[model samples]
Target: MGVGGIGIWQLLIILLIVVMLFGTKKLRNLGSDLGGALKGFKNAVKDDDSAKNDSTDENQPSENTDESSSETVDITAEKVAEKAEEE
Candidate 1:
């Protein structure tokens, strides 16, 4: 037989009943309200993500200590090698 014994005709009848109960105007308004609520929820989630990033940045130091020291050592070694090559 059909899906779960509910055929296409039965599904169409149910849809017709629902449309008759709510009417076209009410259904349109309901759809618009649902869309607006979803949009607002998405914006709120994005704002939360941006706020978290800002707070994390504020708590950490801008310059990492280890990286700066390693870079300075590399530059010193390069200069010493250059002077030896000139001799």
Candidate 2:
């Protein structure tokens, strides 16, 4: 009548057997490791979301567009010089 037909008593028996086999210390260490792994995964996901937001913000037009225009001009000059040298 429980999960997949396994009752609460059966689940308790399984947990007891696992504790007996692994000992309390090993189980504690395993729990902590699992907790740390989940925490790290959460932080990574948060950082990825923030990075995406930052990229979108940068793509929007701003008043300081002159800086970007100067960079484009520099790139164009470099390409023109390269073409002249190839001629």
Tell me the number of clashing residue pairs for each predicted model: 0, 0
Per-residue alpha-carbon lDDT of candidate 2 for residues 36-80, written as tens digits (9 for 90 to 100): 999999999999999999999999888665765766357888999
lDDT computed for candidate 1: 0.90
**Which clashing pairs does model 1 show?**
none
- lDDT tens digits, residues 1-87, model 1? 467999999989988999999998999999999999999999999999999999999999757577656664578889999999999
Off by over 4 Å in 2: 63-87
32 Cα displacement, candidate 1 (Å)? 0.5
Question: Residue 21 in model 2: shift from native, Å?
Answer: 0.2
Query: What are the RMSD figures for all models against the true structure?
Result: 9.9, 7.4
lDDT (C-alpha) at residue 43 in model 1: 100
Candidate 1's TM-score reads: 0.63
Per-candidate TM-score against the hidden true structure: 0.63, 0.69
The global C-alpha lDDT for each of the candidates, from Candidate 1 onward, is: 0.90, 0.93
